[model samples]
Target chain A: MREVAALAGVSVKTVSRVVNQEAGVSSAVRERVSSAVSRLDYRPNLAASNLRRAGARTGLIGALVQDLSNSFSAGVLRALEDTARAHRTGVLATSLDEGVERERELVHDLVTRRVDGLVIMPASTRHDYLVSELRTGTPAVFVDRPPRGVDADSVVVDNASGARSGTEHLLARGHRRIAGLFHLTQIVTVQHRIDGFRSAHEAFGLVPDPRLVVTDISSAEEATRVVDRLLALDDPPTAIFAARNLLATGAVRSLAQHGLRRSVALVGFDDFPLADLLDPPLTVVRQDVARIGRTVGELIFQRIDGDTSPPRHVVIEPTLVVRGSGEIRPTA
Target chain B: MREVAALAGVSVKTVSRVVNQEAGVSSAVRERVSSAVSRLDYRPNLAASNLRRAGARTGLIGALVQDLSNSFSAGVLRALEDTARAHRTGVLATSLDEGVERERELVHDLVTRRVDGLVIMPASTRHDYLVSELRTGTPAVFVDRPPRGVDADSVVVDNASGARSGTEHLLARGHRRIAGLFHLTQIVTVQHRIDGFRSAHEAFGLVPDPRLVVTDISSAEEATRVVDRLLALDDPPTAIFAARNLLATGAVRSLAQHGLRRSVALVGFDDFPLADLLDPPLTVVRQDVARIGRTVGELIFQRIDGDTSPPRHVVIEPTLVVRGSGEIRPTA
Candidate 1:
């Protein structure tokens, strides 16, 4: 500011008034100061200025997801970023990697940076730790899961219903023995999906074989191993309902390797890019990730804009996309 | 500081000394001040302190990529974020969306935020605008594309050679009429891939059909339309070399729709996650995106850590991964 004032041959206060667009600065002096500012390439410290001004925005938000590399999380982040960009706000994205401690740490870090708002796909079961931050007026919107032990806006898919519909689709296809592959049951979403899978069997008045239900499948590779084990069983499942995208990928690989792509019915939860291009075109219970992300973006921005409304929970209904795979009939 | 002092029954200067970790602060006073600070959840604004201290890091960096939703960009971002996390730095990632103006605006915004460093997959043809920022001591490393009109460290895959290898692999499989699908010709990487396509045909003592060489292809849908038009040609190419991943996806869709998945050979430049799972399994010139990301991360952090050497350019060699599509014989 001093350098700009000196270059413009004006007082530092005059330069400040020009920079801040304050009234009472003459056109000639304002032009001179502006030219000097441009020439000097001076960027006023927004972080510092934002500190002094109440209700000043930082023009940046933080998005914490389970994993940025995963298709679902990446898609959600992309949607949030697009929405944020429309408001001229940038997003700082980080992956929690399903670490509860990491989520807390990252939330703390983003809070320390004073992000205008937050969009979190939380790994932690409870978000009580965020109460103080919420109380202090840093609004946050949770995605993919509801916040436990705290009041916050959230957008989540109807995971249990989506899973039930997918399982029911396979059962209606006359597949008597259906296998279920899932992520860790500790995750609320995963547990909800498991509940849906069980409810579908109950609706059909058929008991799901406990031996065919596999959990704790974290990666596609792990899912593949689980599928291989199930396939080798004496009473192998005639169909598979993968409750996660990665698990679905594993099931696809296993079915392909076993030359059973045409015989075994399969349905996956969570649609991914190229799902339609896969052999038999993967059948999926598709959650509108883009919509979920947009909802989260909207909720967080509203809070940032000082909307003092009570927290709202939004549950998006997932749709069944019947591609070739789920339509496959049992050969037995 | 005053609030902490009041809570801890200490002088403001004593709290400041403890927070700054300056010498001459008694451990008892420091412990009392720290407890009070924790009790109040008083986060010392690092942004404000960073402005006052020379060489103080904001513990944040900026990453500007083409798009976050795309597999390549997302993979790179995930790797970079992992590396930055190890260094206790957060990355604020933004997508350029192939807009030069957006790139400039985002760069200026990141600069204004006083990020410690930057990693850019540049959209602009000329980056003389970044010269000022670089001169101002904000380190940046370019990725996927090299920086132009300015000196900066860059990590890029061998585009020309990668394209050439993919084309040659098709030619070796008795494909005389090969279609070349590429991105925008203005992009340096796309242009280099086109050059490689032409050179490979030249090496084989053949001239590529002008009608078969398509450019300006952006999305999978566009690529599919282009492929449909090419297939409608009376003299259609037997093989396709898709220079971009989306173009490959389009080509795959077209072939599948036309019931030519078994007969039409196709090779893609960049490999995607589901490439191997597609019908006929996509053959590709695979650039190690993870490695490229890691290389970019290392270079940028090194620059941020005061490595003032001349700008270094790193080129990674791409490898050919033959699944099934590229090995198909041209049955004219």
Candidate 2:
């Protein structure tokens, strides 16, 4: 406050730096300001004061999440908060809702807030806005999915390899009929997972059954319908690879309804809540959500700190969590 | 922007108001400014322009959540987003991690950004900071729990009634032995829920058992240990109440480990994803997350519009969803 600065014999700007706990304020000046603050009982409106100073940041960061209900996004948001807190920044999160228009609107909203940087988990086909932001030197880091048709720093999981390995594990157990159940996101990550699934079949010299792959169904209700249709076929796949958590839940529900819990093998893409507590625990291709969050946080900060190198895409490895669902023996 | 204003023969403030869609500017003037913007190809940094105005807002609202990982928090946040989008305002979210100091810091952050208003889920034991903000006539609505030690507009669940009703459901089922589980937060909502649980026992001519209550344990690992201790007791309760979703998961894990799924009836506070898909399906008290979010959003907007009436605390009723878990027929 002006009163504190007057008592401390420092500029209001200097008072602001000290109040915000920002670096570059001398210790002597900080001490004087503290004493002045105590003596005057000057409870400053710190943010308002910062706005009056030059180079004062809004202290807001934009986080673009795909779906808030998803456990993975929830975990990532938590991790991102932990990272953002250390830098004295706060997150403004938006759920993309799997719509490009919604994602664009949220991005526009963040930009209009003048957020110093962004951590976007994009679900859009065209990333022109991101490219333009990059050209204008807006600090940003794409997470979960990369910015297509643009060069930007990204933190992604090795979905293709994880899916491939999971399929191979099922095949190695002598099960040739494997199904791939995935969400209907247009992101490249989905394609990679599908690629991995197909590559596994290729490695085993088995022809891929196109009917076993399900896509474009958003909600659990639709997923249930799709899985039911797939299973009603004369020869349903013995093992199912659910590409996402929601799809996996739908498949599990169908399995339970059909009274085939132990008979049909399943390996889900993302982990879900209470997966381990089920009668036959779910096996999932587990992506290290916390690590991915941390890495993306680190990458964004690095980019913000004048890292002028080409945009880097960092891929984290996923592990196969072998549980009862993936190891079920097929009935002849 | 100055050039456009000069060309249009208008003040910079008038030009800004016209350009940014703020009220008070005439339609003719707005059209003139729009034409000038088109002619000059002058794009305004909407976020900065809104801030530069004296009384106009940046079309942004801040939401402070206690924890994003919690299902309750996430559900509320998603609903808030939907409401905000409908109102054409962008939401800036921050996670407080249930720390008073952190909540204080985030409030300051939003204030500095000059967010039009705030929808805060306060974590502080006292609401001195919020009181100060309210004194300054800053529009804010507290959600999930009322602001402690401060009078303000709030949207909260009837935790006591919900818990009491839940306990009564168990009591009516001929089970004298029942245990209560709750997260440890100095929050009044938690206490209210605990009170209701106690009230149920008191009504049934039974004394509250100290050994049957667990508090100060929130994390899954901690809950796991607490549930283990509860189950190992010489006279373990026939029914158990886990306060929140994570605790429910922990209790389920503990139950599964002991192979006592159907033997002991369980009820959880919050409904979670795939609660019904489980082997026995979970019984839970479901909070109206969407209704709560909408009410909080409306309250914040009302406050922003200068609603200075006596503070109102709106309590939404929660519903008890009886699934297979609580409906199990106890065989003595």
Candidate 3:
């Protein structure tokens, strides 16, 4: 690298800039560096070992999703890994487990191991923790959720719009008494989805009963209990909108136990495995996970290849799948 | 390392073993090596460099499974990763899509990168290709299947016995005409399951109709088609045994479409997510994935820590879960 720098009549910093494909380098200067690099056959190691310095790549990508075991996250991971595999890069997979500290720790671990870049589904409400790594020129793309307190590339679904479509689907079916089951987590996605649900009711010139909106539904068991309580109310809802996958499953179980699976209408927010094979099947807001994952890979690789443009936040559209359950009549 | 070896009055090889905590070293020698290591404050770069000698540890573990998106494989990976995380180690995950060349290529890549250990769910019919890595002192543990052509640590469920149990469950219900649907791929586990299916019929002093046994059944769609064909036969099986999870899913869909879900008895080899949510529910032989994963982790880590004992093959027991589907009496 020093020889190349001297041969090109440039400083080591200039050589690094050219080698890393950093933006803002002059074309003429780049040509000179390219000539020197070709003449000397210099391999720049982006990751800091002397022998590895010959290549500008580390051949490793870090994937920090919330949970790799979950179907949604797992599908996205499969896409990312397949894409990376075609390019001959290995992925370091981690489960964030909804712990901010754990996410930060794993990220730090991957960074210290000198992975070329990262794909993250951040657990923290704020991403100020990532500023240092980004400044150090590490490439990253956030998936599932947008980053807060820091600028970065992101690929996410239009949660609010998707939720609004689902809610309106029920409203159009003549279900005036609709109940909502939602997660109480601080995740920004929940808020966006709730907003869409309210907006759907507002558009129809109706008010959603505050008491019908149940929060703090975490696990499938909890979702089942929440639905059970809703049904036990004096004026039970004619339809229910489950805001998450597990919640929908729990609702299914509860409905089955109460012999309401065929009577009460239900629409879920996310598509899950075998959702189409259920007795009445399940209607859901389906996001193209593979497309989202691919887009995320593209952005992260672009940054790795030295595109220092403004950060991109790509919002993918979600479509409503109207299977039997969601299309059920109010049956008043 | 040289200084530590000299101070401990041992060879550099002994120093390496002591530092890596390999077994078979005398306690006195281990104590001396520890004291010498403390005195020198040695930090062994398990992963070698141009500066590092060849055959050093990379402190990374490679996990190659069939499909990480599938629930069974995903569950195993989650458990393995959780175990690795506690030890401050990272995991490199790969999905082997039934391509032998792909599996070999990935193993080569990981070996070249000098990962310290590996956990593989082989896609190849034989694993003789892994001989070189095992010979080079790299720790490996095979999951879901035992390694062939070369010896290595492994943790697998008893597929044959599990299948036998599921088959007998249906036979006990007086279903003489039982159909079999299994993966076409020559996965050893699947072969064992087929053997068990044949064994069950033999035990009952009856011969299985060759026409009723379908092979090369790959996906859920294929399973459904196979079941539909069976039902259309002149003497359709009164009970069906699908030997895989996806196969079970397809069978359920086919039965529902033909309106035979309640009438025709069904028992599957593997349990899947939401099996209980099906109308009559699904009965299956369930493998303890968490235990398999944990066992694989233990064996691999043991090898990494210098326990060069004979390759230990651990066989986990599978249990038969009786839901409604398996207990149904044959109609007509």
What does candidate 2's lDDT look like per residue over B75-137, in tens digits?
Answer: 898888887877777787778777889788777667656677888898787887566655545
- Displacement of the residue A138 alpha carbon in candidate 1, Å: 0.9
Which of 2 and 3 is the better model by lDDT? 3
What share of the reference contacts survives in each candidate? 0.65, 0.53, 0.49
- DockQ for every prediction shown: 0.72, 0.45, 0.25
Looking at model 3 chain B, report the run of 10 residues with the lowest lDDT sum: B43-52
The deviation in Å at residue B76 for candidate 3 is 0.6
TM-score: model 1 vs. ground truth = 0.98
Off by over 4 Å in 1: B20-24
DockQ winner = 1
What is the total number of backbone clashes in candidate 1? 0
Q: Per-residue lDDT for B183-295 in model 3, tens only?
A: 86488998999998989998898788999999888899989988989999998999999998999999999999999999999998767778998878899999988888888
Model 1, B56-81: lDDT tens per residue?
A: 88888999999898999999999999
How many angstroms is the interface RMSD of candidate 1? 1.3
User: How well does candidate 2 score on lDDT at residue A258?
Assistant: 90
Q: Cα-based RMSD of the predictions, in order?
A: 1.4, 4.1, 10.6
Q: List model 3 lDDT by residue over A161-243, tens digit each.
A: 99999999999999999999888658888888899899999999988999999877888999999889999999999999999
Local lDDT at A97 for model 1: 86
